[model samples]
Target: MDSSDFTCVDVRRDGFVLHVVLDNPRSDMNAIDRAMHDDLTKLFRMLKQESQARVVLLSGRGRAFSVGGDFEWFRTLRSPHALAELNRDAKQLIWDMLDVEIPIVTAVHGYAMGLGTSIALYSDVIFMAESAKIADPHVKAGIVAGDGGVVAWPMAVGPARAKEFLMTGDALTAAAAERLGLVNHVVPDAELEERALAFARRLAEGAPMAVRFTKMAVNKLVKQALGVAFDASTGYELLTFMSEDHVEAVDAFLEKRQPRFTGR
Candidate 1:
């Protein structure tokens, strides 16, 4: 993959590990917009096909890993064309990440919300900062967590617990995440990147074919679960993107007030 294809992500290599860092253009949260989603899909697809790296370390550039969708771009997504395009990219994002043959280690600090949480949790291993948080806030936004949460959350944290958080859009602190088995390790905020890179380097040093194939076999479960939930979830998300409650929610959010749902 030509690094030129990415405008918002900083891609670099450390030995056999590839690092992709999110450079948030619109906000401190590294929010996902259609363009970022499209770029990420392209990156993951390219990684699936031609990455020579044995491991990947995914992280964000600044304070937050990502805090979900960019509200400005989000406000324009009510159109069918916009929603449909994003829906397709959402599915491809999940599919291509799963298809990538190498193992991925996520170093998450700050908030990982919605698409951010989806991306982090789907990785092979997650190293989160003790002060960081992970959540899928689509429900709070009055939409489905269809970016990949319906599959990734349940697989990592189990269905019963998944429902509690996903249904409420509540955050799980990194410490809590580790306790719940959602994150592989939790470290001090300052050590987050170092630990993740160290772990990725360790993975890179392992017997190459065996480690990659092990990742493949383990991810087969993710692929199987995703096949069952992804289509319906994303479709339902698109449907809700145009809902009365969703509009009300966005309006209320912009107005800095609570939404009154009429259930239209």
Candidate 2:
């Protein structure tokens, strides 16, 4: 994919490794707006056809890995058509991320929240910075933790623990994330990117077909879960996006006040 093709993401090649950076146009937290979301859904599909990049190294170009859906985008979602499209895109994005055969190593810096947390955990290997954290704050915004949160979190941290954090929208520190199997390793902030790259390089240097097939073999588990839950989870999430409580939460967020959800 041409670097310019994806306005919100930057892509560069380093040997057989493709470096994909999440650089949100509006903010460093790399919030997901429609453009970013579309680019992401297209990314893995683009990579799947390529023989050049044996491995993908993903990271954010800012203080936070990502913070989730953009507030401005949230304010514009008054139309059912837009919501329906976004819901499908959300499902497509996760499936594509899982469908790719090349190994993906994610470098997590700062906080990875909502879709941020989903992408991070979906990576084949995750290297988190010591001070970084991960969470799905969708519920805090009065929405279901749709996307891959329902699938990946339970697989990583076990169902009981995943429910605790996902339901509460709580954050897990990098160390805690590693302990809970949500992340593979937690390195010092200074070494985070380099360590993640090293791992990607190792995968890139391996016999290409062997690495790709091995990745695909392991992803069967994830695909199985998606088959069972993706449609329902994203469906429910889109419904929540239309709720009065979701509107109040967004309003309260902008006004910097506690949300008064009347359970409508």
**Which candidate comes out best when scored by lDDT?**
2
Best-fitting candidate, measured by TM-score?
Answer: 2
Residue lDDT tens for model 1, 120-153: 8888899999999988989887888888799888
Q: TM-scores, in order shown?
A: 0.96, 0.98
Q: Flag regions of model 1 displaced more than 4 Å.
A: none
lDDT for model 2: 0.89
Structural RMSD, model 2: 1.0
Expressed as tens digits, the lDDT of each residue in 1-264 for candidate 2 is 758879888999998999999998788789899889888988877877777889999999887889888877887875799888888788888888888888999999998999989998888999999999889989988889888899899999899999999899989899899998888999999999899999999989999899889889989988998889888888888888899999999999989999998876
* Candidate 2, pairs of clashing residues: none
The clash count for each model shown is: 0, 0
Error of 1 at 51 (Å): 3.7
